[model samples]
Target: MNKVKLLNISIDNISQAEFFEKCKSGVVFTPNVDHLMKLQSDPEFVNTYKDATYKLCDSKILFFISRFLGTPIKEKISGSDLFPAFYQYHKDNEDIKIFLLGARVGVALKAQEKINAQVGRTMIVGAHSPSFGFEKNEEECAKIIELINQSGATVLAVGVGAPKQENFISKYKDQFTNIKIFLAIGATIDFEAGNIKRAPKWISEIGMEWLYRLLAEPKRLWKRYLVHGPSFFWLILKQKLNFYVDPFNSDYSEPYKGVTREEMG
Candidate 1:
């Protein structure tokens, strides 16, 4: 699929329906402004996104910017939007097993319980909550991988946060031969588990979800939205003025592939 370059990140121009239909067993990411900015100085993150099977735009802010830049993305397919929809789509398709990884202690288990009560519980094959630095521990990573294999899950949703979740999936996705779908959903699990409240529909519709989030957890998110958020505009301005260098060649953004399916293994 052809992707447009906003900040050197290839944002796929796909709609909600097309993205869901494209979903399968592979590393899928929903890149927002924070994620795209991180890709600038972080080569590991850049490499992770480069190999991603699906790069869905999660930020409404990015959507507006894309349109302003004359490279409009069809719609936003964020982790929160995609996660519930994925389960709802497979509500009757019990063959689609799912594994919930990441989140604070007991969060995944509680999320599984809530989802099970709402949808069918049988599809949630396994859930785990790794320690803060569990990824750094070889034995811990081994156990986590083993648990996923034992669960026989086809879909894996990693809600451990941005670059960490992305790096984890990129590092170990090939190890899960039976796995199909991987989502680097930031805090969707916490939202599902009722630990955090989402913004009202109207707020989200108008593209102020970030503001709502900043209000919800001011201490934690202040730096993310308040500090790092403002810098994104300068990058966009640079791109618009034909000054920003797209490492993958600026020509790749043309012939926009508005919608396409993921190549599932």
Candidate 2:
């Protein structure tokens, strides 16, 4: 696979076609610096989820921080940004079909309408909104898979938040071999459907996108930015200091006790 470097992070540079081909029966993580630091610090978590694969991507905040720290890191096109390319690809090739899974209320349909209008035509075959909680609805899940299969969708874009979306993809990839891509695009549909606003280019460039989001939905995001943001930074710093220590030398039995999968889900 082709690759690029920005700061110290190496990013894979696979085209949409190549990416779809590579993602068979495995989970792909769009990791930022914070995610990398967390994984490095907690090898047990990585080991526990060894079935999953990871790809480093440049979050805007991480990009700015890397520049400030004088580290080299290159930005890879994110899952959210894949829509335009995928839409064009679908137009050119009539064989491809896509499924949009998960979004708040009417956002998925709105996104479908918008994309269809923007592209003149679209490959979107089906869409759904799963419930918020972690409790599994096996019947509903099976119905979703059946619907995708019936619709002949070759790609699935899951809008569920991580790592639930990641978990779902990892769990269900085998059942849907006809599906070429399973992307866990966090909040992309909401932004596309006008339910949420993405930060302006300047704000994103300056790493204040989080601030913009916080300002927009303070009740929902305040804790994530104000609390988790600082903690993430501190964890990154600690990981940097521990670079000399052999990461894998530590006992694998010790798990990351701070947060449960439920909390993250």
Candidate 3:
């Protein structure tokens, strides 16, 4: 498990199996609304992307979780639901060391305190709150790498939001050889730290998590859930119609089969 290269990301080439193999410790499988929107725009491109994503999710060595509003199925759980499971696993197995990175100013510290109080001597090695932005100074990047390496943590939970967090892990993966797992858990740190309230179980179970999120933070998420939500459904419909006539002989409609989109299409 030392320096295993599982992910292959090139400009013109990508493989899903490689990504899954790389998650021997653990990996994050995040699907933001924006990514789904991008997929809806181009089924071929998205199918390729999702193929790689789902392969990674299927890894047994890696803990799979998605940070999304509504999934295709009713019984699927959100990333928030899996956080406690991850915590409990670490609590039971003292060999796994965790490092918390990113979140609001004091959110990481608060989360560390909460987990420690609850778990009673959990195996959290260290925690830090990184500044929000893409361009990181040399000093900042060096500091983060040094902290992770010195902390001796195997799992690192990053909460700096999409693309940014993913890019950060890609940039620094080689620096922390001891780090086996890297999770880009968008806003889970805030929710776990009690900085934000999660939606009720009933609301989440019914796939109305988007509505609850909109009510909670309308200004920030209105464009994402409200505007983009219907747009996704519309794109789904269009793809369905295209599949029915076999215009291009594409298989985009099969992934969402037995669902409303399949019936309507």
Candidate 4:
């Protein structure tokens, strides 16, 4: 597996077709500007990323950044796109049962219903909508884990935002003895349930999805896009110039650790 380095993280330089063919079992995390920005300051999130089996480029902006860095990523595999494709690809595979966790109180169930209808089968076997700050409650997490295990789901797709989703998966992944694939997919459940509409394909292709999302939920996403997002460009520039330093460790400045050839299998 070839990976491209960005700041302190490595993104798999794989296309969607390649991802489908090779992704048998592992944790999948889609990294975007917001995620990268958070990674700079969030040590736990950075550590959690080390546990990721597939650090996929989830933003067109990242694609452009990779190109600018002279190590272009093969594709931008957003969780929103990947989740649907994954279910469709495995629609006929009886053993590929998926459990969707996240979204609002009823949204995961709606996504489950819609996805099953689209696939013409119940590929999403279980759906859970955890309460606000549910990850903090050990009892709730235990119950959720138990529910997923009882559902016989082989895959777990968690759509809670950012570090919480990743952190939850990292902490409790070992508990789910039956789960093979873990996807930390943010807002995908909302898209599937039609609770939120994605940006137009052209907008996404042209790298304006951030603007589209900012416009859609300005109050919620303004800080992510308008405030924290600009820092990512600056950081990318620093990385390009070999001047970027990991905030967690002032001595670490080696951002050009490119093409990590790992035995993912």
Candidate 5:
């Protein structure tokens, strides 16, 4: 498999169609600019990423950067796009039962309803909007795990945002005996639930989705886009100049080195 290395992380170089064919079961984490920045400082987030079955490219900015690095990614497979495609691809498969975990109180339920309606069947078998800071509470996490197991879901898609969602999956993925596929999809649940509007296709295609989102929720997303996002380019430059360093490992200097789950262990 081909990989596009940006700075400290490597993104899988795969198209949406290829992803659908290859990824039958396993944890999928889509890495964007925000995720990349988070990985720079957060050892926990980096560890969580190391456990991911698929580290997919979720940002057009990252895609463009890969080109600048001379290893162009095949496609950008953002979580918001991947979720709809995933259900649509498995629409006829009765075995693809999905349980959504994220968003506000009624948001996951709304997303479940909308998705099932579009798929013409109950593709989403269960949905839960976990309380804020639910990841910190052991009892709450265990209860949620039991709930998902009881729902008979084969796929679990969590859209709680960033390292939180990724860390949750990394810590408790094995506890889900019935779940075959796990997706760390940030904000997709809210988009599906109609609680938030996604950027238009044209804006997304033009690689201005971040700008659109920043404008949409200025107060909430300003730091992610304005503050942390620009550092991605500087990191990319470091990689290009062969001066990039992994924060966790001082001796390592490779830019395009990909780390699999086994490699991490």
Candidate 6:
């Protein structure tokens, strides 16, 4: 897979189809500004991304910034977008069982119900909404891990929010003998369940989805959008101007450096 480094993180430069083709089993992290910013302080989060099967671009602002920095990412492959596509791809793939982990109480169940109703099949084998800080309790974590393992799910969609989802998987992934795919999809469970409405298509196309999200939950998202968001643009400027130490430096190795699916085919 071809990749480019943005903020010292390896971001896959692949089309949506290529993304689906390549994703098999392993952690997937979609790095937005918030995630990238947090990476500066979170070593575990950084390692999680480093070990991910797919480190996709999650934010349009980050995509624009990548272009402005002259190391363009090919596309955005957000978990919210991919979750629906997962169902679409696996609609007839009964063998590819899925599990939903980490939503508010009943959210994943509702999402599963909606998927079953609309898709006309039963793909989700299990859904769990762990209590807050359940990870802190060894007994609870063990029980949940065992439940997931027993579900025999091939894909696990985790929505407990960033580092938590990633950490949860990291801590117990080995126990998941049947699971192959895992997505650390923050709040996508809410979106999938219709608990939170998505923005209009036009808004998303114009890269104003962030604005819509900000307007949707200003109380919870203001600091992320209004405060930390500006710093991203500044970081871009710094990268563009070569104004900082090791400005825009990327040491990422793309093993499939010049390869593509079409060419391989």
Model 6 superposed RMSD (Cα) = 5.4
- lDDT per residue as tens, model 4, 1-265: 8888888788999999999999999999999999999998898998899899999999999999999999999999999999999999999999899999999999999999999999998889999999999999999999999999999999999999999999999999999979999999999999999999999999999999999999999999999998987888898888888777767655444554342324211
User: Which of candidates 5 and 6 is the stronger one according to TM-score?
Assistant: 5
Clashing pairs in 4: none
lDDT of 2 by residue, 110-146 (tens): 8888877776766777777777763288788887787
Which predicted model would earn the best lDDT? 4
**TM-score (C-alpha) between model 1 and the true structure:** 0.91
lDDT digits (tens) for residues 1-265 of candidate 3 = 1111111111111133343334456445455444455444444533344222221221111111111211211124245655565777557667677888878788889898888777778667788998766336768888889988999888888877655666677666778968877776777888889999988878765567778888999999898777876765554455444332221225443433323323445
lDDT of 3: 0.58
* lDDT per residue as tens, model 6, 1-265: 7787665566889978887776766788888888877775677776666568788888777787788877899887777887888788878988788899978899989998988887787888889899999878999988988898898888888998878888888777887888888888899889988999998877776789989999889999899888877876776576566542222223423332223223434
Kindly list the per-residue Cα lDDT of model 5 for residues 46-141, writing each as its tens digit. 889888889899988888888888889989999999999999999999999999999999999999999999999999999998889999999999
Q: What is candidate 1's lDDT per residue for 122-211, written digit by digit as tens?
A: 878789999999888989998999999999988888998878999999999888868888888889999889888889878877789999
Whichever of 2 and 5 has more TM-score, that candidate is 5
Give the count of colliding residue pairs in each prediction. 3, 7, 0, 0, 0, 0
- Each candidate structure's TM-score, on Cα atoms with residue i matched to residue i, is 0.91, 0.76, 0.69, 0.95, 0.95, 0.89
Ten contiguous residues with the weakest lDDT in model 4: 256-265
For model 3, the superposed segments whose C-alpha errors exceed 4 Å read 1-24, 38-75, 134-138, 242-265
Question: Scored by CA lDDT, what does every candidate get?
Answer: 0.83, 0.63, 0.58, 0.91, 0.89, 0.78
Instruction: Specify the poorest-scoring 10-residue window by lDDT in model 1.
Output: 256-265
Looking at model 1, the pairs that clash are 25-180, 25-181, 26-180
